[model samples]
Target: MSEIQTVPESRRFLSALGPGLAGALSVTLIHEGARRVLSHPPRMDVLGKRSLKKGLRWFGVRPSHGRRLHRQALVGDIISNSLFYALVALGRPRRPYLRGVLLGTLAGVGAVLLPPFLGLGRSPRRAKRSTALLTVAWYLLGGLSAARATRTV
Candidate 1:
């Protein structure tokens, strides 16, 4: 008779947790790098007019647009974090990095669209800050849960 090998549930859970941590850390590093670049406040003319326009479009808006788009980006970051944590909680591991990027992008768009669509045209700074804080909190929670999962295995 052939024996059936069964993996322990704890091991399976921990394996899933590993990828989630990797994804979260990747996001945090990317975010910090982007912040560092922004802090330098690159000159508009140094990059040239055409390149500058392209960059603004890629980032989803012009510099003259104020912090509205920036706030959306922050909200997107929070949404991405939430998605990562939700995946971890479900023990699902498939394209974590890509998923993070997609979720982040969607969140950014949502932040831009939601307020104006709902006719709540106030500054988005407060909402952005709140979202960023929530993201950090979610990351902390995910880390703790992953740690516990590791210990169990």
Candidate 2:
């Protein structure tokens, strides 16, 4: 009789790490792009205000005046997508569009849930929404980066 071998869950989880890291890198790139787009002084101020309002609305809470919740959202976005990618890499089934959507949803939910639970600042709805948006954005960015890198080689 022949013996069969099975892959361990930890090994599968480790395999997923690269994709998760890739997702984070993609997000960082998009964030840099957004920042560049809003760099001009007048545009910067306008975007700042809009981002804060959006972040507040996203989490179903009011933002402190002059607070940069948008930036925090960007951070949360990276964290959430990275986690999803890591999960997927860990031998989880892939669903392409659905995966991105699920990741975004989780990111939004976590953003709203974590802060208050940890005795930090109030959960910002706008930031949650922004995190969700960033997840989708990172997915697109990751695909594009992969495609471009493949072409260059």
Candidate 3:
């Protein structure tokens, strides 16, 4: 008789990490690279930076400025995005691309709409139309990357 073998929970989680990190990296790269060329770039990292600063202030910790702030914000963004994308491991959806689109849309909408409600101020939706669109588009790109990685990796 053959005994059944099950994968450990931690191993399952680790399996998702590679695809998740790939997606997060893609999103960051697309946004940062675009910032140099766009006259009115969507400032998602700025939003993250501001949120981080507020969190630090709440804890009475002094936040860094300029380049340091940017680095911290980018790190935070990547880590958070990685975890978010890693949720795919739980579902193991048959259609990963669709899952990617749905997940990305949800995140993009939240990014555009949640800021004002959270006292984070105006969202990308309040900015120029292009900014709003690009904000969503980059997220979609990340989702696609993650979904593709899920299939291949």
The best candidate in terms of TM-score: 3
Candidate 2 vs candidate 3, lDDT winner: 3
- Candidate 3 has an lDDT of 0.85
Model 2 agreement with the true structure over 83-150: per-residue lDDT tens digits: 56565343234343445445545543554455556444445433555644453444555544432322
Q: Per-model C-alpha lDDT, please?
A: 0.44, 0.50, 0.85
Scored by lDDT, the top model is: 3
Pairs in steric clash, model 2: 16-89, 54-126, 55-126, 55-127, 58-125, 58-126, 59-124, 59-125, 59-126, 60-125
What's the true lDDT of residue 126 in model 2?
39
Tens digit of lDDT per residue, candidate 1, span 1-153? Answer: 999997687765546555455445444544545446654321211122333345567799754333554444444544444445435434334344444444445434444345445444432334466544443433344444433433333
TM-score for each prediction? Answer: 0.33, 0.46, 0.92
> Candidate 3, which ten residues in sequence have the lowest lDDT sum?
84-93
- Give the candidate order by descending TM-score: 3, 2, 1
User: Lowest summed lDDT over 10 consecutive residues: which window, candidate 1?
Assistant: 40-49
| lDDT score at residue 12, model 1, on the 0-100 scale | 59
How does candidate 1 fare on TM-score?
0.33
Question: Lowest-lDDT window of 10 residues in candidate 2?
Answer: 39-48
